[model samples]
Target: MIDPVIIRTMKTVKEIRLENARALANEGPAEFARRIDSSTQQVNQFMGPSPTRNIGDKLARRIEAAFGKPEGWLDVEHITGSDDASISGTRSAVLEKLLPEGSGNLVTWETPDDLEPDDERVWIDRYDYRYSAGNGVIQWEVRQKKALPFDIGFFKALGVRPQDCKLAQVHGRSMEPYLFNRDMMMICTAKTRVKDGLIYAVTFEDEPLVKQIFKEPEGALRLHSYNPEFPDKIIAADQLEGLQIAGEVVYRSGSGLAGGN
Candidate 1:
């Protein structure tokens, strides 16, 4: 028989590992494993919270390196810190240590304003894909592209590169009153995981949509709308064909487009 105490410890450690992984990359197992140069099956099996599997020291070091964590970060058995009732305690503590001050709210994905002088800035391209947020009224084509420069600290804090982002504008009411029409959104093309309750830009049925996606227990995707006037749409697992997820909506600006800083 399996030891219950060992099983409990395994579950706790695995949960922490998963939490750190999500905080660092916000990616699915496959992409995370790829970034770590590991296999998806190994990551899933070793990191599954319910499984009583131990992460070897070698693999632990790999995870720490992949997440840009300090050595021995994954060796701890128990973590202690302030716990916010409304947010994740582990995530907050881990991020607090890694990110600069004023970058507290991870859910909102805000970066600190006082970035170090050594932080570099790079210009990235904004494609011509106008994904409609209301109805399918805009053309989804790559045209009239332009490049904008952004500070690297903003993306480094999120474990992403500026080149992995796209500058897009919201153009419909289906996503309002949160993301209004003509609002600017910084979409992270690399963060492809369909995490629950997070906003994403996806091409559904050859049409673009900006909505919150929730993975149902039965494996269907529930496209949710912030406005109560719009009904939630469901897409079965089998019907997920041609669903190209543009990326997670990291930042939004109701004022105007993000300019060079």
Candidate 2:
């Protein structure tokens, strides 16, 4: 028989999971499951009424890491007061951490000089070139469309320098679900080294493509697509000369795109 203490602890963990689910309601269960490196079914089962499974130590750590929470954050309950001021303060604190200064109160600044020094915002160039995720496409010419502002802290958290990052749109169904058609991707040019299972923007035979790269033995490389409908492309050691890795895809913003493990 399971110990009563163990049962109570499991129940408390389940309750905490429920609270986290509520907090991440905007991302939905599927995204949350993806972030926690777990399947949707597992998330639903543990978060369900009268859950049959308990969140193990490994899964709890994954959840904390995925959500930017501290270690063992899920092991205890966080109490929030019923007062409106307390709730507002909590929300403000979250926003402050996630957003740049003065972002909470938006105002039109005629020039960069009008912005305050504490803004800590970095502008990333949004190139007009598209990286094909299906069949490769030639980048005729590189042109800067505009600069998008992002919090400097955000880049620091991702371990990417602001200047080394460039924004481009993904154009193909091959990388779908994770990278949909016209999804904006942030590529860290400094990280051109191939890391297995990580998605990258690359140039193959003068055509730019976005795909997950896997380094094989004998200096060969395999380009993989998220959509199973698209078969993986293998580049032999001899053919590697035609392949040029632009950068690692650090972030993607689009509909239904979730954080990958």
Candidate 3:
């Protein structure tokens, strides 16, 4: 016998698919498929009258990520609309439902609607790449234009220039208790100097990683992870020439500390 929970989940997925299709009516199916990392033909099959495939858990999560929706977003029923305020409100409600009480201030999904003429916004370059916190990932250099916006004052407060900041996402749990998977990091590209007891986004042997670095007395470097399961990696002074310090992790958003380590 089929489980009722499975049936309900499938129904929810279908509803979400239809709603997303309607929302992307202007961009059409091709763009929607691109966003979800699926082919247009597969998308049509899922949306067709006689469907041959079902939305699995992995695909549902991928859809949510592509649309910038929170996890389990597709499992619930949401009111679809063309109104901007209504859409924003719905997003806020979803976030509130997922976050713990008193932690609501940690995340904000809305852009400030009230800004004085003198208040300037700085756009930080964001890359469609993830820096592995466990096993390093091969670095990809795809920059998304106008990814994150910050108030000009924000840079002044951090003592870092706006132009020097870049945003990237972290993947893996090797740096757990300090940095979590899928955390959005604000990297100061200008600060490449090796500093002890600091987290950095670096490339070693062509693999990009987010790890805390400690300079040894003999000019060697130790890459550290907060999660004890992962042992620290020590690089000999002579091999340091291969290490490229892309930037120091100045700020992070997600389930981690906001300040640099």
* Predictions in order: lDDT: 0.66, 0.73, 0.71
Q: For model 2, state the Cα shift of residue 40 in Å.
A: 21
Report the lDDT tens digits of candidate 2 across residue range 31-129. 878887777656656553334466778877777888888997877766455584466456546544654454433434665677677668897878744
Expressed as tens digits, the lDDT of each residue in 17-111 for candidate 3 is 55554344336567878898887667755543334466667877887788888887766656544585476456445534644345423223344
Best by lDDT: 2
TM-score of each: 0.47, 0.54, 0.52
| RMSD from true fold, candidate 3 | 15.0
Assess the local accuracy of residue 11 in candidate 2 as a C-alpha lDDT between 0 and 100: 46
Best by TM-score: 2
Instruction: Rank all candidate structures by their lDDT, best first, as comma-separated numbers.
Output: 2, 3, 1
Q: Candidate 3 clashing pairs?
A: none
Better of 2 and 3 by TM-score: 2
Which pairs clash inside model 2?
Answer: none
Per-residue error for 50 in candidate 2, Å, reads 36
Query: Which residue pairs show backbone clashes in model 1?
Result: 134-172
Candidate 3 lDDT? 0.71
